[model samples]
Target: MTDFQAIGASRKTANTMELIASAARRTVKAAIPAVPGGIIRTGRNAWRSGKASKVAFLVDGAAYFSALDQALRQARQTIWIVGWDFNPDIRLRPKQSSETLGELLLSLADENPALQIRILVWGMGPVYSGKSLRLFRESGFSSHPQITMRFDLRHPLRGCHHQKLVSIDDSLGLLGGIDLTARRWDEPDHRVSNPVRRSPDGTPYEPVHDMQSMVSGQAASLIGDVARRRWKKATGQKIEPSPVRDAAWPLAVAAEMTDATAAIALTEPGLIGKRGHYEAFRLTRDAIRAARKHIYIETQYLASFGVARELAKRLKEIEGPEIAVLVTKSSHGLIEKLTMGNNRDRLIRRLKRIDRYDRLRVMYAVVPDERGGEKEIVIHSKLMIVDDAFIRIGSSNLNNRSEGLDTECDLAIEAETEGHRQAITALRHRLIAEHLDAAPEDVRQMESEKRSLLETIEVLNCRERGLRHFAVDIAHGGTTPLPGTAIVDPRRPYWPLHRLRLRVGRLVSVFF
Candidate 1:
């Protein structure tokens, strides 16, 4: 019986490998119609405008809550939210209202007779355990006539809905790492020592630092399409196009901008039930491959072996562009630090080996205080800027779980014109400025002093070490020495238990 089982396992492995090979060949042969040069040139022309199509940023919990309230109020026809976790009992504005998310959603449904609300959440995770699912059912969302909520179980046995986005009436959208849950609220100040935070039950919660973005125009419409498709997949219902009506929300268009083009990128496994469309991941690879000057990447995790290999390949070419990566240092809670922090170490080791020119540098963002104490500001923003001509912001992290196991959505804008390029550059400076609590102009001046924007801030902030810096150093320094390969070898004897734990972790990562 054992011999028979061994033979069966070997056959299964061979079959899987053959399937993967076939998929690869099909992907290579697939024809992605070339985007016309005229369109590309038009986008290039729009880069001259020194303004983004639409710009809004959300920091901490207050910002997230405010953005959600404003989006719901402004939505005329539809409201769609996708999340890794969704707690109906959590209040959007605990300080102002005692109503939980469920009540608030029901109220929206009651008020907007013509509006449709759809909520998609991860189906198999701690957040969606049996009891939690019961809570969801007990919440008004399950019975609300105008609201539709469903658990997204699209992937194999272990996969998750990890995107956090809210689209309103096809006119406005919010995307980033911020989730609508408890313990996610805090002010931009990120008062570390302060003991004042409001939870849904009026209990105090700890402060957290995070970021999200609000967008409008064509970009919003594109994101809405993504939401609609996912909704259909989960609920088997097609969304009727509901044109945007309310104009009260701030939606700005660049005045002097010219020739700017924006596109959305998504990432998923190679094959999904037949016809191929890993367009998002492919676009990301192509963007990296095409970079001529520099690439600035910001993500929550950096554990994708495939991405690391691609980066190493680019770095090895010598003539390729410089690459800079910004990730969270180790200050996460015990469990998170053990899992994500361990992956960070493995990633750093892989990067070090591939960095032949010493051009690649990884750093953590720190939030400093007046008296010299600092804290590691968690980098929840998923952003990548290439040569000031392209920028991407969304919920996708740079981890194996994100790439192959979980669902994600990202927004990308290419500024081909000088004005648009300048606008994007200014936005990048603004993000850096907010992180440093410095004026935008000050951040801009510091930009030229160092090789990368992250380094510039680190140098300028040398004198202002506080809880933030201490946390960053401690977190980054504590990781075991990196291994040599882009792909972590769980079998290696010297590899830390954390690394081995990650191998065990793969079982659940599909739903993480």
Candidate 2:
């Protein structure tokens, strides 16, 4: 089958316009030669992204918030922030700076005459009142002339703009799932109770694990382009890109890879007359198919039917890549429990049944709490590493909303040199080690001894406070999805009778 045919995206009675889009993508795919493995090219499955001169992976909130604080401190011409939410009261560097995010931005605006800061977020930002920033009403964003924050209202019903991006002076870019919000700060050690990990209100929250990346050069400018385009769409004002400047990447933080090819993949629901962008979904599917040795995925939600299908097919193969999937133990709230939680359970059960070769592992992490009981460290990161050759990180979850109903952006990197490959592998090992409470080198040694990631994890996992397989920890969500799953975790935009359509579509994807 042709590559596009191999894609064969599941659909529910696609309209003529969508059909035309598929056909057009097919034509484009036909003209361009199939991209070789490990190389990212603009075609059906990918978009054109700029090359990076330097890249660093920010593992936890400590690293992410610190790098972001330094980059924002260096902002000169322009700063663009886009995200699902932000909390102005959260300090980027709690010990180093006493200023809240709002205070810091205000201070920077007051200091620089040329710098203009713009923040764009989902219209429902206020609904997440306790978590997100009050930029509109109480926060000082409305008072400052140099800084403007706008809540984006342009989306299909129930859909949202959920991208986390920061661009400074068009010279540096920070992108990942880590948001500038309260209850989002935690160290790599993931100590259950750290005095510094409390929120602005001094309330302690759960241990959270997340990922972000800092980059410069053409890649940073391209990321700046992404932020500016969204700014114009949310507000009618056009913001021009600033000229690139010398970005002194923060000290003591090491670069993960230098001089690598990177690209941004987006997931945008079709709104108004615009075509939907599902490149993130397509890229995940293709990445799974292309994997030869191992596929490591860490996500907050694991409820995408499209991605489940891709992974199920791989698990059915006798010689497919060893897949290691890590997800949070439960949904955050009651509403999410019925929708995201139930869907995740059913998918996990189905995959476990198809693991004839025993190449699949679904797990979660836990740490010893101060009270001597184990506490589940929230796996808030959305990242994937395939065979040590490719790495992707961003706000895109493995849920239905992230596939097409919500706006998302993910940074994907293709390892270009020996150093890049080694770095990618080291990153995966380090992250896995965090869960195992073992050293990265120990994880690497275990992997080298056991050819299978499943076997490696089994050997290293401690029964008390490390990674636990889903079957041992989480109860099954039943063979069928719970009622109202489609309403809460929609895969497509709401149309007339969209609820009925979504229910029907779920039935089709799961049973067929």
In lDDT terms, which candidate is top? 2
Per-residue lDDT tens digits for candidate 2, residues 1-512, read 42212222211222246544544554443333234654455666565688888899999998898888888888889888898887778898887878888888988999998888888777676577554344546546556888877777656667778999999888899999988888888888887868898988888888899999888888888888889877766665677789647767777678888998889888877754568788888888878877778899999999887788878777655456789999999787888887787788888877765554567777788998778788988999999999899899999999988988888988999887999999999999999888888889988999898776766777778546688666532234464466776778888887765455445434432331
TM-score of predicted structure 1: 0.73
Residue 268 lDDT in candidate 1:
43
Q: Residue-wise lDDT of candidate 1 within 89-193, one digit each (tens)? A: 676766677777778778878887987888877665425433465655574567677887676655433445677888888777778787776567777766655
TM-score per model over all chains = 0.73, 0.87
How many steric overlaps are in each model, in order? 30, 1
What residue runs in model 2 are displaced by over 4 Å at the alpha carbon? 1-39, 131-134, 472-480, 496-512
Q: Which stretches of candidate 1 lie over 4 Å from their true place?
A: 1-61, 91-100, 125-134, 137-141, 194-207, 243-248, 251-260, 269-272, 314-322, 331-339, 354-356, 368-374, 449-455, 463-512
lDDT of 2: 0.79
- Candidate 1: residue 79 lDDT (0-100): 85
Overall lDDT per candidate, in order of appearance: 0.60, 0.79
